[model samples]
Target chain A: MSMTKLTLQIDGRSIETESGRTILEVCKENDITILTMCHLKGITDVGACRLCLVEIEGVSKLMSACTTKVADKMIIRTSTEKIKRYQRITTELFAAERNHVCSVCIANGHCELQKLAYDVKMDHIRYPYLFPQCEVDTSHPLYVLDHNRCIVCTRCVRVCAEVEGAYNWDVMNRGTNVRIISDFNTPWGESITCSDCGKCVEACPTGALWPKAVVQGQLNKAPEFISDLIEKRKMKL
Target chain B: MRVRKAKKEAEISKNDPRVKFLANKIKKENYSPGSLIEILHTAQNAFGYLPLNVLQYITKALKLPPARVFSTVTFYHFFSLKSKGEHTCLVCTGTACYVKGAQAIVNELEKQFGLHSGQVTPDNKLGVAVARCIGACGIAPAVVLDDEVLAKVEPQELTQKIKSKLAAS
Candidate 1:
C-alpha cells in the first residue's frame, strides 16, 4: 500500500515525513532540537515527562512530540518562547522536587538531567527545595536505586518490562508521593522477580539507577544501545 | 529463565496458601487481564494487604507482567501492601478539612498515641490514615472510624474516641 508523505513545518523549516513517524523521530533525524527525558526507544512512550511538549497550531494545550504521531501539514513548533519557558520550568521543577545536588551525584557530568539543565540554560531552581528524605537501596549486588534523584519517568520500569522481559520495577503512590519500587514494593536486593540484568540501570535518564561497579562521576551509560538491542532482536540469525 | 523459576518458587514457598488463593481467584476470572483489579480487590479483602507473593501469583496466573500488577496495586490508595491494625481511622485532610483544623487533629493523635498518619500503633490496636478527602466536605475535618464517619471533631475528643475505639476492638 502506497501512503502519502506529509509535509510539516517545524521551527520554520518545512520537512517531509511519512505517516506513523513521531515528531520526535522526525526532529531527531533532521537534527531539529526537541528535549526529552522519559523516552526510551525500545519501550512504549508514556510521555511521563513533560519536557518534550510542543505547541501545535490551533491546539490550546501543548502535546508531547514523542507520543504525537506526525500528521499531514501539521504546523508544529518545537522551539518557541513559551515552549522554552515551559522547558526551563520543567527542568527546574525536576531539580527542586528531588535531591539533585550535581556535585554528589554518580551521573554527574554524564547525566541527562544535568545536560538538560544546561540545554535549557537553567541557572538555579527558583522553587523551594523539597529535600524529601528519599531512600537509597543498595540491596542488589550490582545496582543502587536512589529515590532522591528519581524524576519518576518510569523508564526503568518500562525497560525492565519491555526489553529485559522482567517486570520488576514499578511506581507506587501518586503525585509527589509516587516512588519506583521493586517487586511488590520490596527492596531491589530482595526482589524475587528481577533478573538483575542491568538494563534498567542503563535505561535510567538520571542518577536514580546505577551500577554498583562504578563510583560517582565515573559512571557511563549508553541508552541508545537499548534501541540497538531491540533492532538486533529482529534478525533471526 | 532457570534463575527466574528458582526465585519464584522460593517466593511462593512461604506464602503458599495466600498465593494459591490468589491463583484460584485469577483462574476464576478466567485469566482475563481486564479483571486484574477486581481479582486484586478480592485478594486484598481476603488477606487485608496485597503481598509480593499474591501479586506474583496474580502475574503468573493472568499471564501478565509483574510490573503491571505491581503498578495497579500501588496506583490506588484503596489497596495497601502493609498490614493494618485491628481498628482503622481515616482522617480527611482536604482543603476544607485543613481550613477546619485537620492538622491539629493529626498532630494531636501523633502526640498522644505516638502514631503518625498511615501508621499502625506498635500494639497493632489502631491504624491512622491520612486521606485527601472523603467526599464529606460539608462535614469538614471528618474522621472515619471503621465504617462510621465522625464529623466536626475536636483533637482531644477525637483522641479519646480513638482510644475507646481501639479498646473496644
Candidate 2:
C-alpha cells in the first residue's frame, strides 16, 4: 500500500510527512526534541506521563504528541515558554510524588527520571513531598520492585503482558493510592504467571525495577534492546 | 475430609441468595468481560460490598486476570472492598456544601460516633463517608443515609436521624 503524504508546520518549520503516524513520530523524524515518558518503542504509547505535550494551533488544550496522530495542514509548537513551564512542573511533581533518592538508588546515573529532571532544569521540587510509605519488593529472586521510585508509567505492565506474554504485572488502585501489583497484589517471587523473563526490568525508565545483582549507581537499563529485539523478530531471515 | 468440607462450603454458597443472585446476573450478562462493572454493581448491592471471594468468583467466571478485576474494583469510589456497615451516612462536601458548614456535620459525626469519614463502627452498625459532590448544591448541606437524601440538615438533626436509624430493629 502506498503511503499518503501530508504537510504540517512544526515549530515554524514546514515539513511533509505521511498519514497515520503520530506527531511524536514526525517530531522524532524531523529531529525535533519532544520529551516523552510512558512511551517505549517495542510495546505501546499510553501518554500517561504527559511530558510530550505540544501546543497545537486552534486547540485550547495541549495535546500529547505520543498519542495524538498528525493531520494535514496542522500547526504545532513544541517548546513554547508555557509548554516549558508545564514540563518543569510535571518534572517537579514526578520528583515530589515519591521518595526518589538518586544517591541511594540502583539506577542512580542511568535513571531516565533523573535525566528528565536535568533536561527540564528542575533544581528543587516546588510541591510538598507526599512521603507515602511505599513497599520495596525483593521477593523476585533476580529483581526488585520499589514503589518509591515508580512514576506509574506502566511500562513494566505493558512489557510483561505484550513482550513476555506473562501478564504478571498490572496496576492496582487509582490516584496516589495506585500501585503496580503482581498476581492480585501478591509478592513478585510468588507470581505464578511471571515467566522470569526480566523484560520488565529492562523496560523500566527509573530505579523502580532493577536486578538484585546491581548495587547503587551500578544498574544500566537498555530499553532500546526491547525495540531492537522487536526489529530482529520482524526480519525475514 | 477436605473434599467433604469443600462440598459442604460449596453447598452453603449455592444456597446463599446473594451468591445465587450474582450467578444469575453473570449468566444473564452472557459472561462477557465488558459486563464486569455491571456484575460488580449487582454483587455490591447484594452483599453490601465486594468480598475477596466474590471478586475471585467473578474473575473466574469472566475468565479475567485477578489483577485486572482487583484494579477495576479499586479504581471506582462507588465500589468498596469492605462492608459499608448496616447504616451509611454520606455527607456532601462540595464547594457549596462546605460553605454552608458541611464540615461541622462531619465533625459532629466524628465526635458522636468516634469514627472518621470512610470508616465503619466496630460492630458494623454505622459507616461515615464524604462525597465530593452529589450535585445537590441547592440544598447546600445534604446528607444521604440508607440511600435517602436529607436536605438542609443541621448537625444535631442529622445526628438525631442517625441515632434513630441505628436504634431501629
Candidate 3:
C-alpha cells in the first residue's frame, strides 16, 4: 500500500503533505503555529478544547485542525481575524471557567494554559469569573489533583487509558459543575485500577495534576514523553 | 442481630432488578461501547441516579475504562451519579430571573426546606436544582416544581406553595 502525497494551503502558503495527515500535522511539519489543547500526540484527538479551531475556505463553521484530516488542495487559514478573535475568546473562557490564579498555581511558570494565554495575548478576561468552589484531592500519596486549575482537557484521562492502560481518571457532573474524578468519582489513592505510573501527571497541561514533591513554580512536566512513548510502541507493532 | 441485619440488607440489594437489568442491557448490546450511553440512561431510569457500584459494573461489563464511562456520565445534565429525592424543584437563573431575585427564592428554599442546589433533602422529600435558563425568561423568577412551573414567583410564595403541597400530599 503506497501512501499518496497531497497538498494543502495554510495561511496562504502552499504546503505539501501526505494524503491522510491532519491539518494540524501538516502545520506542525511545515512550522505553522496552530494553538491546541486536548490534542496529545500519543492519544486520539477528542477536540474537547476549541483553541485549535481553524477557518477552511469551503467550511462555514470553524473546524479543529487536529481532528480534520487534510484533503487535496484544501485552503486553511489558521491566523485569520475570525480565528484570532475566537482563539482569544477560547483562551479567556479557559481562564474564566476555572480558578486559574497564576500566582498560586503549582505550574505557574510552566503551564501550557498560561503559555496559551500569553500566546493569544489574553490581557484580561471579559467573562465573569465563575468562582465555583472546587476541591483539591490530596488522596494520592504521590500526586495531587487540584480541581481549581483544571481545564477539563482530559489529557490525564486519555493518557491513562491509551498509554498506561490503567483507566483510573474520570470526570463527573455537567457544564459549570464538571469535575475530574478517579475510578467512579473516588479519590485517586483509593482507585482500584490506578497503576501509580504518574503518566497522567506528566500528561496534564496545567497545575491540576502535580506530583506531591513539587511546589508551585518548581514543577517540570514532559508531555512530549507521551509522544515518544507512542512512537516507541509503534516500532513493536 | 447485626449479622441478621447485614444479611437482610444484602438480600434486599441482591433482589434489586436494576443490577440484573444493567447486566442484561450489556448482553443485549453485545458488550459494545457504542451502547454505553443508552445502558447508562436505562441504569439511571432504573436506579434514579448512577451509583459508583453500578458504574463499575457497566465499565467491567462493557470492557471500558471507568474514566470513559464517568466522563460520559458527567458530560450530560440528564445523568446524575448522586442520589436525588422523590420530588424535584428547579429554579431558573436566567438574566431576567436573576435580576428579578431568583437567588432569593433559592435561599428561601434552602432556609425553609433545607434544600440546597444540586442536593436532596435529608428526609428524601425534595431535591433542588438550578437551571441557567429554562426558556421561562418571559416569566421572570420562575420556579419549576416537578412537572409544574410557577411563573413570576416570589420567595415567600414558593415556600408557602411547597410547604402546603408537601403537607397536603
Please provide TM-scores, in order, for all candidate models, with all chains considered together.
0.83, 0.89, 0.77
- TM-score of the candidate numbered 2? 0.89
Write out the backbone clash pairs for model 3: none
Please provide, for model 2 over B37-128, each residue's C-alpha lDDT reduced to its tens digit, 9 standing for 90 to 100.
99999999999998877887898899877778888888898899999999999999999999999999999999999879899999999999
Give the Cα lDDT of each candidate: 0.86, 0.90, 0.86
- Considering only N, C-alpha and C atoms within 3 Å, which residue pairs clash in candidate 2? none
Candidate 2 whole-model C-alpha lDDT, 0 to 1: 0.90
Model 2 docking grade: acceptable
Candidate 1 residue-wise lDDT, B71-129, digit = tens: 78888777888876778888899999999999999999889988888899778788888
Q: Which candidate gets the maximum TM-score versus the true structure?
A: 2
- Candidate 2 C-alpha lDDT tens digits along A18-64: 99999999999999999888999868899999999999999999999
- Model 2 achieves a DockQ score of 0.36
TM-score of chain B of each: 0.80, 0.91, 0.75
DockQ of 3: 0.34
Strongest candidate by DockQ: 1
**TM-score for predicted model 1 compared with the true structure:** 0.83
Instruction: Give per-model CA RMSD.
Output: 3.8, 4.1, 6.1
TM-score of chain B of 1: 0.80
lDDT of 2 at A217: 96
List the DockQ of the predictions in order. Answer: 0.41, 0.36, 0.34
Candidate 3, residues A91-117, lDDT tens digits: the string is 999999978999988898999999999
Ranking by DockQ: 1, 2, 3
Question: Residue by residue across A140-168, what tens digits does model 1's lDDT show?
Answer: 88889999999999998888888888788
